[model samples]
Target: MNSDDPLSLTSKTSLGAYYESHHVIGKRLGQSFEEGQRGPLLKRWIGTGRRVLDLGGRDGQLTRHFVDGNHVTIGDIDAGAMRLAREALGVDTVEVNLNEALPFADASFDVIVMGEVLEHLPYPHLTLEQVRRVLAPGGQYLGSLPLAYHWKDRWDVFRGKKLWMARDPTHLQFMRYSDLRKLLSTYFEVVEIVPLKGGKKAVRWPDQFARVVAFHARKAAG
Candidate 1:
């Protein structure tokens, strides 16, 4: 949908519901969450003092982990998601559309997180450019994306159904590791590309699928 379309607002509610349900389930599962597997990257990239911007951070499930007496702003296009985040985590939030330029001033954030958000946007390059603009020189950006040929896609293919990644109207793009690396290279220097370890059951065939694609990138110095 185009910018200013009412449907965009309505869709946010639907997306928020999906996110809340999944986040609640993930929290209950504890160790099953991807956060634990992503710890190394977070530890390496995030320092003790920094201001963070979490773009499309639904319910602030992951953002809360990084906000330890540091400035952290959770941003999403969905107001319901923002409300859920504030109520559950008591974090500050802002409503923003990722397809458009972000409202923050240049170099306003020391770090930016866009976990699992790249696939949903039609214009990821624009989002990355905005990300580069908002982050201070040498600032870090951390996030994950579902890689192509993941188990979920294979399961859907076996079942004669389209994968959610392919069929979801809101997911405008899918990327392989190489493609994502190439995209990020234009805006930031790639630091790490780590394959996420799934739950015990999914770990059997490691090469066949990964839970997510986690990466760290740093905005280039001027």
Candidate 2:
């Protein structure tokens, strides 16, 4: 593959392969999910008793929290993660590439959860369009993003430092909190938006201080 060519679906598939070897700092790692940063927010926002689609939810780690009493289908580009989510949680799985349109029927789910996955997409706006299309009227969209406008990072740029949020090359896009908010508002109504790891300062100025932001938004009824 030409290095200049855009990241291919095969490359994205390879990226998903990493989930099999690693787990986050929460319940998947035998630690308390509730104790982890932003854990309480995710659990509270993602409730049960409805159909849920977990975009890029690899290996049933974060999906386990609301899996019970709610029917779930995990969509990912990784075949290994798809098989493992089924083996781990007995949930349905679909192999999907978010760069393309979603295959589900219109208004297919009561909720859609996309966590830390959008930044890796070169076409986030396109994917979020599908997210809006698949969600049932008034259904929720729950997700998180690494805030690109963190004050420290801004300071670093002022001091002539170059940085990327993580070592992972898949993170293809970064935007200020306001930029993200505007994009999301195109499809979903902002119900609540909050910061993670931003502390008291973030409460007042999330766009300036938050390391990440979690959100609960609603699809408008037709």
Candidate 3:
């Protein structure tokens, strides 16, 4: 499959299946493991009483963490995913294609979570731009992305052999830390970059492979 063609219908279906299975496993493991990782970032938003937009919130697992007493809306391109999330987590949700502009009005949210979503977008920057437009000034944007070295560099080898990250076909982009940072800086003032643990190592040295990066950024007040 060509790397650029990530939005193929077949790919979307495959991703839907993968996400369904992944969430099942995550549920069995308990939500704490996932929610615990967000402690540092979540603490910053706690008690702020802000509205949140969770972009690409598959199955709403992550959205549940922040919706206890806050207004949260989950959005995703896949209706199946959104339905699953709504049914499983009992949260409000909208169907949206991230590559296209978001449907909300400007400054519509105080926080936007793009967790594990950008890599699937064909035009990640466009989504970020919409994110900036909808976020209130000083609103936080918290999320995570897969680093290039994550998961044993399977994609890299696939790329070397002329395969694309969108092998399942819904992933339009694959970004390393540097690339994502540079891209996000255009629309947001990055405040922090947190590395996640337990990823596979590509080399003996620690620097060789860093799998995931979580970031906290704020939309600039006009």
Candidate 4:
């Protein structure tokens, strides 16, 4: 079983089943917060009426925000999740394995959203390279990743609260702020790095203790 293959769930682990069962309910709670908190920021960066891809978008929860006045497509490895996304969000979807080359034509998207997906992948650099390939010139790729060692997650571990948001077995990679910038710079020119919730002041402080950080990166125009 290739760990890099996003569809390689052949290990028959309970994790896939857990995601299938909890994808909807869990995302309901999560999407509410994200829509209220992060959606506006992403919209500001993404603008309106352009091709957008939500990579690893489970159940198209986050895809809903962009659908009203824009073209949105979702890609994920889970068939159940993709089915739910199409049924619930009424958006286009394609099966994808992040470790493998994306199944889209070159420069197929104007904007790409990759929220809370990088930390789960085994090869983030390769994923970013593929993202670069699929993105049009000057296209934007927006993403979010949790801090590698947040104090709250540490507290959660201390309290043995390993349920739901507390801990995830699927999180294979942990990264710091510097690590994120460096990684994305390999394939993109990072234009902005901001906090998921707080506004401008958070950018000044750039809290290392924060749970997650979001970014806006662009493909260089040839």
What do the candidate models score in CA lDDT, each in turn? 0.73, 0.76, 0.69, 0.75
The Cα error of candidate 2 at residue 98, in Å, is: 0.2
Query: Best candidate, lDDT-wise?
Result: 2
TM-score of every model? Answer: 0.76, 0.83, 0.73, 0.80
Per-residue alpha-carbon lDDT of candidate 1 for residues 31-140, written as tens digits (9 for 90 to 100): 32377655545655676588989887776667667767668889986566678778877778987878788999999999998877898888888989999999999899
Candidate 1 segments exceeding 4 Å error: 1-33, 39-44, 150-159, 198-211
Global CA lDDT computed for model 2: 0.76
lDDT of 3 at 205: 31
Which residue pairs show backbone clashes in model 1? none
lDDT of 3: 0.69
RMSD of each candidate relative to the true structure? 5.8, 4.8, 5.8, 5.1
Q: How many steric overlaps are in each model, in order?
A: 0, 0, 1, 0
Evaluation by lDDT, superior candidate among 1 and 3: 1
- lDDT, residue 127, candidate 1: 88
Better-scoring candidate (TM-score), 1 or 3:
1
lDDT by residue (1-222, candidate 4, tens digit) is 444333353445454554554454344423534556566677778889899999978777667767777788989876787787889878899978888999999999999999888888888889988999999999999978776645555677689765234355567787766788888898999998877643554456555455568899999998
Give every collision pair in model 3: 166-169
Better of 3 and 4 by lDDT: 4
Q: How high a TM-score does candidate 2 get? A: 0.83
